[model samples]
Structures are given as C-alpha cells and as structure tokens.
Target: MKIKIPTHEDYQSHDGLHYYQLWNSIGDEWLCPACGRSKFQIMKWTQRFPNTPHSFMGWVAALHKHHDHSIGFFEPGQTRFPETLICGQCNSTDGVVKRMLNLPSNFSFSPQEMRTFIQATPHGKHKINYDQALEIFNLRATNKNGIPKVY
Candidate 1:
C-alpha cells in the first residue's frame, strides 16, 4: 500500500489512516505529510511530558544524534507553525482526550502496559485496576483527560 508521508507541505489524512507529525524535528529527520499542518509548531518538552513515554526517549536520542531539531520548546515569538492541532483549522481535542484513555483500544498505553508487555511473559497476566489506572491519564494544563476542552 502506498502510504503518503509528511513533507514540507501540508496534507490531511483520508480514511482511518492519519499521519501524525512529530512534535519535534531533529536535523533532517524525514518529514511526513502529518508534519506539514498549518498549526505545526516545532516545540519540545522541558523534561519530557508524561504523555509520551517511548517517544520521549527516542526524541532525546534524536537531539543528541542530530545537529538540527534539538529537542527544545519552540522559541517565544515566531510565526505560529502547524501541528498545534488546537488551532482553528484542525482543532482536535479527541486526540488529547484519547491520550488519557490509555487502554489498548485507546493507543495511549499506561505504565501498566509497559510493565505487562515487557515484564510479563505470554503465560503471565498483569491485572490493572481501572480506577487506579485512570490516574495515569492526568495531563498538565489540560483537563484530566489531557484534551483542552474550553478554548
């Protein structure tokens, strides 16, 4: 299947297959279609947001490995780039809401998933308490679900 990737130009996801642009870019890292949104701002986390677990590690590595796209927040006062998602065009709170709902179905796996997937064997089972598990979903500056509900 020919999957369209993000370039310097903007492209939208058709059907169920949406390409998400990277929040940070590291020196010539391949840009896919998702990276070309109008709201795409090249921002980095101060200390890696809890939301991105595996990606945090990878992003750190990219910063060290590459000369460009060093992992740091976008400098204050610049043209607001694409990929923000909260902007007028592609305002998607669902993505943030889904971030909090980290079930296997939700795509945002909790720490439990890491423990279960990495520590547990196929025969072993790691049971998670739904109430306690939801605590992992708390997003800073946003609602508990992690999505910005009110503008």
Candidate 2:
C-alpha cells in the first residue's frame, strides 16, 4: 500500500521563523536504528506573508546518511507510533501503525516518490538566508512501542 509522506509545502508556514522554530521544537538530535546514525538535516523555504516581509512557506525534516535519506510520517497531532518510517538506505520499511502491519520489510519509496514527496520543493524563492531557513532535524526523547527514538 502507498503511504502519505508530507511534502515540503505541507509544513506549517505561518511565518519565516516558524519552520526554524518547529525544527528546534522537535528536539536537537535523531538516530537511525538500522545504522546507528545520528546526523539529520532540515530544509525550509520562505515566501511573502501578507504585509509582512517574508515567512517560511515550506519545510522538511529528514534523516541523512552517506547515500540516502529518510523521513518520519506520523498521524496529525500524534507524535508516538509513526504510521510508517521510510528509509532510503536499504529500502527498508518499519511499520509504526496497525494499518501498516502488512507492509513488506523491503517496501520503500522510489526515486520518483522521494522527489514528489520529499524533495520537490524549489529553493531560493524568497529572501531568507539559507541558514535562517535550514536547521538540524530533531526527534523527541520519548519511546513508543515501534517508533525510533532521538537521543
């Protein structure tokens, strides 16, 4: 079955500082259970905010490895037990919700799917500095039954 991944545009964009604040709010560290990697990255875009100079228009938080990336998908307003965890490396799938219980261990998003879901947003569309829009992806410090934890 296909999973719904959040596009950059799906991120909250109330203000230019919103994405950065969101990223920081998520926490400051993340770890990949399969590879024990701790490096994560975030991307954000800026656009005019009605009368205001500019605000964050898009954002994405992803786990970064040497040759691949992954993102977490959880229920809206729910932080524990992600619906699915898609890992680009090894194309592995970890079912985090009951509906995904039947997903194959090897199920993974394709290159095109990654583009459409994770990397389709264009950059440099506004005047925010790259540093201002980007940040380190953070994971929370709690443990769910199946979801990975950030430390």
Candidate 3:
C-alpha cells in the first residue's frame, strides 16, 4: 500500500489525522503522558482505535497526537502541534473510557487526566471504571487565566 505520509509543511491547516501524521513525520523520543511509554518502545497491540486493526510492526512504535477535541488546544504559537504525544494504547484507552462513560462526543481527556487515571486505577488493555474516571475527569484545573494549559 502506498500511504502518503504527510510532511511537516505538507499537512493541512486543521486538526485530526493530519496532526497525528505530522507528529509521526517528526518522530522522536516522545513519551506518552498517560503511561510514560516511549514512541520507539517495543509494545504490542492489535488495534490503534475503534474498528481499526493495527499491525504489530511499525504501527506499534507510532505515537498519537492527543488533544482536547472541543478546545483546539496546543502549544502556544503552534498550529500543527497537539497537546501531547501518546502511545496507541494510551490514546485507544481514552476512547474506550469516553465511550463507556458516555462523555460528550466532543469531550477528550487531557494528558494530566489520563496520567492520573492510569496511575490511580488498575487499567490495562482499555478496561477502566467509569465512575473513577469521571471523578478524575472533573478534577479542578490549576491553570489560571492567561496561562496556557501545559503538560
């Protein structure tokens, strides 16, 4: 298959697949904010997201661009950057948590939230408790006005 990986300058001016592709293009030692897993770490997974079958080759080493779907948040002055780089498992778990919790379609867990939840709960392979995750999801923010949310 000839998948066209987007270059840093060739990506679109919006978010979504392109953002993740851009991150993959600029591959580095990015750590998943949730599990602290490295991009190059040799992990195993059969899927990246819902309904998506993932191969255990290059796909396992790919990092995902995790961000709040509703907020359009990112590093200040950066358009293509996501809030954080997360491993496929971590990012996939977020989707499972959101779906099971019935969170708003646009609701996305921030990196801090994912980190706390993963640490506090015994989650593996995307199995997490709704009530516990919900509580952490609503945790009070420490960021003050005029301060950008930093990981």
Candidate 4:
C-alpha cells in the first residue's frame, strides 16, 4: 500500500517558510500561534466505517469511509510539509532545526569508519549489517539530548 506524503512544495515556499497552517494547529511540534508555546488542545478524530458500519472497522472499510477531518483552525499557506517543527508564535516553519542542535558522541562512525572498524577487528566480517563494527564504533550510544554526536 502506498501512503501519499505531500511533496516539498506542498508544505514550503522558496524561502523555507511554511505555506500551510493547518498542520501547525494539530501536530506536536507546532507552537501556538497566539501563545507561542509548543502546546495546543488535542483534537480527536472519529474513524467511521464505510457502507456497513461497525465500531471495530476493518482497514479496507476505514479507507473507504468518508469522514470530515477538517477543524478549520488554520488557513492555507500557514504550514509547510516535511517540517518536523513549526513555530506557532509566528507561524514560522523550522524543519529539522531542533534536531540539529547537538550531535551525540555515538554517531561519530561514518559508513567508512564502520568498514575500517570491522576490517581491523579480529574475527570481523564485512557485511551490510555490520553488527561487529557497530560495537567498535559505539554508534549505539547517544547523548542525553539524543542528537547524533559522533557522525
């Protein structure tokens, strides 16, 4: 099954700002347009089954169901697609900005580093899934902030 994700232009303009506002109102990373805080009232969506209605609906039925999900809280050109974070205060789109704040020490091993590590270790084997190299590189460990520090 193919899930349709909006294209880059679907969410952002040439200047890197959000062109749509609807996502900012409901998504977790969106700041409050009025309060400028990363908090908002959680809205629940009721899923309905198509044709033959039932409380526990099948995926196929859910897909065919016609449900109105629009809350009308935001306007067009108010949000950007592919954005993980939105500044609700000014309706500014900050995609991946928060994630790049810090790199944890564990991500230091690049793909080349992994290859070298595996080759140098005794009893090591080179494979796409380098379990042995991972141990030597310590790529699994991360900082408290969860940013990739070592890459």
Best model per lDDT? 3
Alpha-carbon shift of residue 19 in model 4 (angstroms)? 29
List per-candidate RMSD values in Å: 17.6, 16.5, 11.1, 19.5
lDDT (CA) per prediction: 0.26, 0.30, 0.53, 0.27
When sorted by lDDT, best at the front, the candidate numbers are 3, 2, 4, 1
lDDT tens readout by residue for model 2, 1-151 = 2323335345443232433443344432543333232223233232336466665454334332222223333233333323332222312222221123332222333332322223221221112122211111112222456455432
Per-residue lDDT of model 3, residues 1-151, tens digit only: 2333334333322232434574445544555677765443313322446455753322333357687674533334433324776766677778888787776555577676676666421112444556767875444222445443443
Our model 3 lands, by Cα RMSD against the true structure, at 11.1
> Estimated TM-score per prediction?
0.20, 0.19, 0.52, 0.15
Point out the worst 10-residue segment of candidate 4 by lDDT: 58-67
The clash numbers for all candidates, in the given order, read: 15, 3, 0, 18
Q: What is the lDDT of candidate 2?
A: 0.30
TM-score of 1: 0.20
